[model samples]
Target: MTTDILIEHRRDIADLKQRIKNRRLQVLGLFGTPIVLAVVLLVWAGLKISFWLHSDTPSAINNILGGVVAFLVLSVIVQLVAEFSEDFDVWRDRKTSVRELNLQLSLAEERHILEARRRTPPSMDRQASYKERLPGEIARLRYESQHYRRVHLLMQWLLFVSSSAISAVTAWYDPPQPAKGVLIGLGFTVTVITAAAGYFKPRERAFNLQQTADSIEQHATALELGIAPYNAMEEASNLELFATTVEGLRADQRMREQQLDQPQQGQQHVI
Candidate 1:
């Protein structure tokens, strides 16, 4: 664990933790999408009823149709978004079977590795060397992790602002019918986007990927520091152990990924 390696490890873990929190918030925000839309629809329904009670048949009918049209369009958008979002979750898994081969790296040796790495030239490419050799599975996992983290907040805000606009349109303002229709359409679009978020499960997937990545990093560090079984072993033996451990982690990650294809229970949330 040279200074560069330790620094890279800290950066990676910190990024993962922060991303996990953001993704979770996005998930919650997504679950809130439909709930918000439904509330808006209910309010519209009440408005329509009130109009009918006052003998305003045409206005009442138009209001009801506007709400219905918005709801349907929103549903379509939700499905489309959900379909794409599925590809973005960073699923991961782990295996305990490989524990037998792991060298129980001690704190002292770990410190020495960091000190040695720090003493090395600042230009050393330790992080690159490890990542350059990354297998396809790990590469895919990395892509998903980054993709979800970047998109989560964007999606959350998109839904929030879009839905809020619909709630803002009201009898109090007496917005023109055309303006009302557009607002309703916007509501539907945002609702669908939010609903799709609920369907895709990005938060769970990102978490799994982060966990698997962490495991790989820890094991690789153990080997780098010559700790435990990796410590006493020949270079050739250590490489073999390292290879098998990474493969095991990948296998577990793949297994966890299979669940994304399964049907998920419908969820509703309120902001």
Candidate 2:
């Protein structure tokens, strides 16, 4: 199915869900008044019974109680009748809507499955698969590397500036109690940020990721242009060498990641 159809189905599902929710709320409201009135009627009846047994009660009060009980009883009966009259139709329509929503959800899932299968690389044609996947892989790695690099740089700058500010504030200004407290808090912040930066090693991660991406791109380019290691061999052999080289680079990158994740005694370096 086309993406548009899947999107439309999703929209339909959402609309149906909202309709169902509104209908349920409406049904609750439709029945709620009668229940409340019934409770009121019961309370009034008890009051009426108590007043009837008392000889000192006023007749006017008895009349008012009788009128209120009658009104509550009538209101409850009317509300129940009206609600029951519409309940069956409302429930039937909601049920139909729910079924349609389920069907639409199923169709949307099927569309997603089909899209995934369409994008799956062929197992038999290794070269074709590589061509289909390498560019995207390279782009993703480069993007992540750049993201890490930017974060690392920002954290480093923040640490430097915060440290300098804390130093200047302490040495030059005695200031107020609140200002001193802020400086202390800033010092704590700097320490935490520095520790976190050291632990995460974003610089090392960025370097390794960028190197791997660049190495993969280089191999791909050489294979495409028929040069160096790829230039002297048959197409299949060249493809094999290219795949092995790329895989090795990826493995090395993974190893580096594992090393970074592990706590070391001293400073960690990218292997």
The alpha-carbon deviation from the true structure for residue 121 of candidate 2, after best TM-score superposition, in angstroms, is: 9.7
Give TM-scores for every candidate, taking all chains together and pairing residue i with residue i: 0.44, 0.55
Model 1, 180-259: lDDT tens digits are 88687977889788777776767667878878877887777787788976775456666666777787888887766666
Candidate 2 residue runs with Cα over 4 Å from true position: 1-124, 265-271
Question: What TM-score does prediction 1 earn?
Answer: 0.44
Candidates in order: C-alpha RMSD to true structure = 22.1, 12.1
Residue lDDT tens for model 2, 177-257: 877987988899899889989899999999999999999999899988999988965677787788888888999888988
Question: Which residues of candidate 1, in runs, are more than 4 Å off?
Answer: 1-132, 135-140, 265-271
Task: Give lDDT: candidate 2, residue 43.
Answer: 68
What is the TM-score of candidate 2?
Answer: 0.55
Cα-based lDDT for every prediction: 0.63, 0.75
